[model samples]
Target chain A: MYAFEYFAPKNLQEATKAFNSFNDSKWLAGGMTLIPSMKLRMNAPSALIDLSSIEQLKGISIKNNILSIGAMTIHADVANSLDVINSLPALASLASGIGDPQVRNRGTIGGSIANNDPAADYPSAILGLKSKIITSKKEIDAGNFFNGFFSTSLDTDELIVKINFQIPESAIYLKFANPVSRYAIVGIFLSKYHDEVRVAVTGAASCVFRVNELEEGLFHDFCSSVVDKTDYGITNLNDDIHANSEYRRYLIKVMIKKAISILQKK
Target chain B: MRISLTINGNPVSEDVDNRTLLADFIRNTLGLTGTHVGCDTSQCGCCVVHLNGEAIKSCTMLAVAANNSEITTIEGLSNSEDLSAMQESFRRNHALQCGYCTPGVIMSAVDLLKNNPKPTEEEVRDALEGNLCRCTGYHNIIKAILDVSKAG
Candidate 1:
């Protein structure tokens, strides 16, 4: 990693002020991803605005049926939170399974979603539950927040403050993970609301996406067998040596069945 | 930049380049060579250390980011030549062959027991997924961790 300026701001206003002065700076969330990227020379920045010390961007809270998690909250904190376990156990379970214990100790939800790796576990939850991303600038719907690939609707200067979710009636996330990295080979997040059902898929494409067919089928039947009748999209998958596109497409149906089965048992 | 932090219960302050990883600061600057750097890419947890009481990959975390933080490395696990409880279990269970990944594996095992003193066999394996040992195949390592948990 090349030498660069480091700034630890006290608050949001100070952090943004520091960011604006440096044309090529990145926000240091957990640095679970960014620091590794720097060491690999995949990224180099003029400076890093550390967000760890900011009080406002660190916690999990439940209020008025909305579960709000501050952006800088680490994965381990979320996984062990009594608030999360009581409100949404599936989400807590998903948090517990990300990377490993060490990775979870330092990795943050803001960093994960902002990076938006196609195989990441958080985006599937974000999209499936339709969480709102509250940025330093404005609040954006989960549907509009993700663009494609590693891209997001966020401007360079925009910093994510917190993520907001409505406590679903029931939600479950199932992932077929890579043996080594533990990244999702194919993940299915099934969320059932009062009026409609959502089916989100990750690692099957360039970005996390909702399967309208699967969603519709589940809406009608809301059972494990719904995967049989649902015709999910399989084009433009984020395929690699770990798993090919054809294999990934097949795993989608397999995971959906598994997820629905587990959710049904609940 | 100069940062202040405590390692193994002692306070230390040092001036370093911003590019310095926490692993380098411990191994290179402080001469605490116990923490190994097997895969600097963060896939291997050779550099796992406790940052403010939570284990994290030190090679991937900037030293500056760990400023004002409490760190516990392999050396920190014991003050004298005596091995810690987890280290003793690893030795009694014959959990290593090359011993290259010992410091990290021991550090990670201790962390697991601290958080969950009596983890199930599956839970023990899940906790140590990041720390890889090419030699042991992880059977005896799992046994070693469960041994400590059972002893208590």
Candidate 2:
């Protein structure tokens, strides 16, 4: 890793000031991804603004059918939190399925969403649950959050404060994890709400995306039979040594079917 | 950069370069070599340590970020009286052969049990999915964690 100045601000104001003044400064959330990228010389920043010490960026709160999670909330916290598990079991289950125990404990929801890794599991839930990301600047809808590849709509000076999710009637996240990396090769999130249903797919494309066809089918008939009869074209999904684009396309269908089946059984 | 944290029940302060990782701070600066760095990426859990009583890959964390945080490495799990329950289970069940991945495995196991003490065998396997081991097929390690949980 290259030499850089490190600043640990106790409050968000001080952190935001340091972040704005420092050239090429990167906010250190959980370091699950950034630290490794730095060690591999894949990234070089002039300064590191540590958000871990900033007390405001850590917790989970639920009220009025809305779950508000601090951006820095760790995966383990979400997986183990009673409020999350009881109110939003699908989200809790999704958090429990991320990486391994160690990764879950340290990796932050904010970091994962901010990085917007295509193979990440959180985006599927965020998109399917119609979550709202509250940043220092403005709130962004989950639909417009992800840009493409590893990109997002966030600007350089902005910091994500919290992510809010409205509790759906029923939701399930199904993932086919790559055995080696533990990343989702293909995952689907099925969220059923009043008169609306969202089907989001991850690990099958350059970014997590919603399956409009499946969404339409569920909109017409909110049942497994509806999704089972739906067709999703495999136009431009991800392809790698782990699985080919065709295989990933197949896995996406399978995951969507499985997620719907699970949701139906629930 | 100057960073201070309570590690393995000991408070230590050190001046370091901003690029120093929490893994290096624990191993090189504090001279606690038990925490090994495998991939230096979050991909490997060999450098896993407890930050505020939760297991996390130390290699991925910056040293300055851990300042004022309480950390527990594998070294802090036992005493002269006897090894911790998880450590003893690992030995009795032969959970490790080369022993390079034991510290991390034990750290993760302690964390798993702390949260879900009565985990089923499948849950145990699921909990260890992040910490990779090439030598063992994870049969004995899974058994070790279950045994400790059962005993406790």
Best by lDDT: 1
Model 1 clash pairs are none
lDDT of 2 at B114: 89
lDDT of 2 at A185: 91
For every candidate, what is the interface RMSD in angstroms? 0.8, 1.2
TM-score, every prediction: 0.98, 0.95
Backbone collisions counted per model: 0, 0
What's the true lDDT of residue B72 in model 1? 94
lDDT of each prediction vs. the true structure? 0.90, 0.87
lDDT of 2 by residue, A28-59 (tens): 88777888788888989998888877778889
lDDT of 1: 0.90
Q: Per-residue alpha-carbon lDDT of model 1 for B39-96, expressed as tens digits? A: 8988888899999888888998899999999999998898889988888999999999
